[model samples]
Each structure stands twice: as C-alpha cells, then as structure tokens.
Target: MTYCVGLSVDQGLIFMSDSRTNAGVDNISVVSKMKVWEVPGERFLCLLSAGNLATTQATISLLDERGLAPAERNPSILTQPSMFQTAKLVGETVKEVISYTTPAGQSADAMFSGSFILGGQIKGGKPRIFLIYPQGNFIEAGADNPFFQIGEHKYGRPIIIRTYDPKMSLEECAKLLLVSFDSTIRSNLSVGLPIDMQFYEADSLKAGYKRRFDKNDPYYQTISEGWSDALKSAFDALPPFER
Candidate 1:
C-alpha cells in the first residue's frame, strides 16, 4: 500500500507520497509514487499515485509517452488548456490502462485498480487539484474541501481535518503534512518512507520547493520525536475524569 496527499492553500499547493510497496512482509521495496511534469512558464503538474504499482506505473508511462510525442498522441497532458482538462485526460488514461490489464468481461479487480491526486496550474487558469478515481471520474478541490488524500489515508486524516486552513502559508502547509505523514508512519507498516514532497507557489507557473524525507533525515527526526512528546504533554494537561 501507499499514502499520498494533495493540499491547496492560499499561498499554493503541496503534494506528498510515501515510497514503500510490498507483496508480503518478506518482499518489500521502495519506489517513488510521485511524478511531475512541467512546461516552465506555461504549466506545472504534480501527480501522487496509490494502489496497484503495476497499474499506476503503466498509466503514468502511457501519459508520459503521449506527452513526449504530442503530435502523434493528439492531446498530450502538457497541452491541456486547463487543469480540469488535464485531470480528465489522466482519468481516461487510468481507465484505459486498467481495462487493458483486466481479463475480458471480468470487472477490473481491486488488484488492478489505482487512484491519483492530480494538482497543478495551466498558464491561463488558477491553480487547482483533483482526486481521480479508478472509474474515470474525479472531483475538484474547492473552498469547502481544500485537500485530498489517497491510499492508507485513514491513519493520517484526523490531523489534517483538525488543522487545515485555506489561509495557510505554503511552508506551514508543508509542516502540517509532515506531521500528518509522521502520524501515519508510526501507526502503519505498509506506509513506510522516504516521503516525497513538492510545493507549488500560487501563480508561480512553476515548481517550488521539493524534498524527500528518509528515516534518517534530521528535520523529520525532530518532528517525529517532538510530536510524540507534545502529544503526551497534551494528554497530561487534560482535566482528569472523575468516575
């Protein structure tokens, strides 16, 4: 399994994903689940994927191949005029890849399914983000819901829910997500790191900060340990319940 999140704040967008995939406890490996595409001043796209590794990789490869030769492939991801259209193209590609992999007449099984959190900005449009499902359908982030998370999401969702704010700065958003990711990592074995994170500043039309956090990263270590101690202190500060 994996964990990926796309958050939208007033300052910009943030994307993050864990890098562990395993067939069994004995067969574990690390592979990046993040893919990024850019056209300099024209557009910037970031994709965070979850679910079957084979399905996700194939879908991305097809998109990348088409993007590389847009003339022959027709509508390339890079050529989309808006973030909405780009998301639709990704959903279609995901559906096509899954359909081809599943046996004829048998519905696409869970083993062959994948999902994505797609976020970016097209030259003439404001930044946006979408959660694309396995059925070739998607929902965009908006005022009410400014973020999306996929794969092993439950373990890390509460923190985001309690603290997310539309007015958060890009750096604050990154810190919040790392705390969320740290919470998830402590509780789930399937979602191990090095975590990949990317930032896109509002109206920048280009990528912003990007980093990968491995188990030994100094900052990550600080956050992880600090959160644990903070949680204990918060618990102790609570009024005791008298039976």
Candidate 2:
C-alpha cells in the first residue's frame, strides 16, 4: 500500500507520496509512487498514484511513451491545452492499462485497478487539481474541496480535515501534510516511507522545490517526535472522565 496527497492552497500546489510496496511482510520494497512532467514556462504536472503497483507503473509508462511519440499518439499529456484535458487523458490511459492487464472474463476492477491525484497548471489557465478514478472519470478540486488524498489514506485524513485552510502558504501546507503522513506511517505497517514531495507555485508554469524524506531526515525526525509529545500533552490537558 501507499499514501499520496495533493493539496491546493492560495499560493500553489503541494504533493507528497510514500514509497512502500509489499506483497507480504517478508517481501517489502520501496518504489516511488509519484510521477512528474514539466514543460518549463508552459506547464507543470504531478501525478500521485495508488493501488496496484503494476497497474500504476504500466499506466505511467504508456503515458510517457505516448508523450515521446506524439505524432503517432493523438493527445500527449504535454500538449494538452488545459489541465482538464490533461486529466482526461490520464484517466483514459489508466482505464486502458487496467483493461489490457486483466484477463478475459475476469474483473478489471479487481487487482488491476489504480487511481490518481492529478495536479498542475497549463499556460493560460489558473492552477487546478483532479482526482481521477479507475473508471475514466474525475472530479476537480474547487472552493469547497481544495485537496485530494489517495491510498492508505484513512489513518491520515482526520488531521487534514480538521486543519486544512485554503489560505495556507505552500510551506505551511507541506508541514501539515508531513504531520498527516507521520500519523499514517506510525499506524500502518504498509505505508512506510522515504516520502517524495514536490511544490508548484501559483502561475509559475514550472516546478518548484522538491525533496525526499527518509526515516533519518532531520526535519522529519523533529516533526515526528514533536507531534508525539504534543499529542500526549493534548490528551493530558483534556478534562478527565469520571463515572
């Protein structure tokens, strides 16, 4: 399993994904679940994937192959005139890959399924984000919902729900996501990390800062340890229960 989040704030977009995949407790490995494509001054795209690793990787590989041979493949993700079209293309690719991987008479929605959180900006349009389902349909992030999370998301969702604000700065958004991830990592054995993060500033039309946080990263250590202590204090400060 994995955990990936795409957050949209007034300043820009923030994406983070954990890199752990396992067939069983004894067969754990790390594989990045984040894919990024950038066309400097024209657009920037980041995709956070969840679900079957084979399905997700094949989908991304097909997209990359099509992008390089655009004259043969009708719509390259890089050539899309808008972010919406780009997301549609990704959704289609995901559905196609899953269909091709599934055996005849078997359910494509079974082990072959995958989903994505697509976030980016194309030249003329304002930045946008979409949650693309395996069925080739998607929903956009808007005023009411400014973020999306995919994969092993349950353990980390509450913090984002309780704390998210549209006015948050890009840096603040990153910190919030790390805290959310830390919570998830502690609670789930399947979502271990070396987390990958990327930032895109509003209207920049290019990629911003990017980083990877491993277990030993100093800042991550600080956040993880601080959050544990803070949580214990908060619990202690709450009114005691008495029957």
Candidate 3:
C-alpha cells in the first residue's frame, strides 16, 4: 500500500507520496513513487503512482525512454501536443502494461493492477492534473475538484476536503499536505515515509521545487506532533454528549 496526492491551485500544482512498500509485515522496503519529466523551459510533468510497483515502473520507463529518443522518431510523452493528449498516452500505456502482464481470458484486475496521478503543463497550455485508472480512462482536476489522490487515501482526505482553498499559496498547500500525509502515516503502517514532493508553478513550463522529508526531518516532526496536540485539544474542547 501507499499514499499519493496531487493538488491544483491558482498558482500551480503540488504533489506528495509516501515511499513504503510491503509484501507482508516482515518484508517491507522503501522506494520512490514519484517520477518527473521536463524539458527545461519547454514543458514540465510529474507523476505519482500507487498499486503494483512493477506495473507503475514499466509505464514510467516506457514514457521516459520515448521522451529521451530523437524528436518525432516515435510517439512519446514529449511529442504530445497538449496535457490532455499526454494523459491519454499515459492511460493507454498503463492499460497496455496491465494487459501484457495478465493472461488472456483472465481478469486483468489482479494484484498487478495500478493507478496514477499525472500533473503538469505542456508549452502553450495551462497546467492540469489527471487521475488515470487501470482501464485507461481519466478525469482532470479543475476548480470544482482541484485535487486527486491514489492509494491509501481515506486517512488523509478529510483534512484536504475541509481546509483546501483555491487561493492558498503553494507554500501553504505544501504544509497542508505534510499534515495530511502525517495523518495517514500514523494510521497506516504501510504508508511510512520519507515523503517525496514536487511543486510546479503555472505556465513556467519548467520543473519546480522538489524535496524529501524523512522521519527525523525537523519540519515534518513539528507538523506531526503539532497536529496530534491540536486534535486532542479540539476533542477536549467539544461539549460532552449526553442522553
């Protein structure tokens, strides 16, 4: 299991993902779930994946290989004309990977299935984010729904839904996401971190800020401890229920 989130605001987009994977309680390991692709000032994109690691890695590798090849030599994420088309290419790639791994006439929805959150901007287009399903369909984030989460999402969703503001600064959004991931980390053993994060400023058409926070990172510790205290205080402040 894992937890990854992508948020879109007026200024730009923010992404966060936990790095723990487990075959069982005794066989846990850590690996990055964030993939980034950029062409300096031309375009910028980031992907956060959750589910079968093999499936996600293959999809990313295919995109990355194509993006690095000579221009127009073959279809690649870099060759797509718009963010929407880029998303379609990613979806198709994901579906293809799933199909190749699953036997014919058998359900492809086995343990090998996975999902992705793709966010960024292509030159000459506004920034956007999409949640791509294993079936190759996707939905974009917008004013009404400006965020997407895949993996162990429920534990971190309430805080985002309650406090998210379209006007919040990228800095503020990053802080909020830390707290959200903190909530999930405390609640789920499978979601342990070293959290990875990325930020993209709208229309910049270039890679943005990036960072990683391990368990001992000062700022992350502060947010985790502060949130616990805040929750306790809130619970104490509420009036007692009576029959």
Query: Which prediction has the highest TM-score against the true structure?
Result: 1
Runs off by more than 4 Å, candidate 1: 66-75, 104-110
> Would you estimate the TM-scores of all the predictions?
0.93, 0.92, 0.92
How much lDDT does each candidate structure score?
0.91, 0.91, 0.91
lDDT of 1 by residue, 36-98 (tens): 999889999999999888889989988888546666654378888889999999999999988
Q: 39-129 in candidate 2: lDDT tens per residue?
A: 8999999999999888899889888875455667533778888999999999999999877777665564448889999999998899999
lDDT of 2: 0.91
Cα lDDT tens digits for candidate 3, 1-243: 999999999999999999998887898999999998888877898989998988898998888775455664443787798989999999999999988988755564448888999999988889999999999999999888999999999999999999999999999999999999999998999998999999999989888899999988999999999988998999999999999
In candidate 2, which residue ranges exceed 4 Å CA deviation? 66-75, 105-110
The residue pairs found clashing in candidate 3 are none
- How many steric clashes between backbone atoms does each model show? 0, 0, 0
The TM-score between candidate 2 and the true structure equals: 0.92
Clashing pairs in model 2, backbone N/Cα/C closer than 3 A: none
- Which residue window of length 10 is worst by lDDT in model 1? 66-75
Please state the error at residue 205 of candidate 2 in Å. 0.5
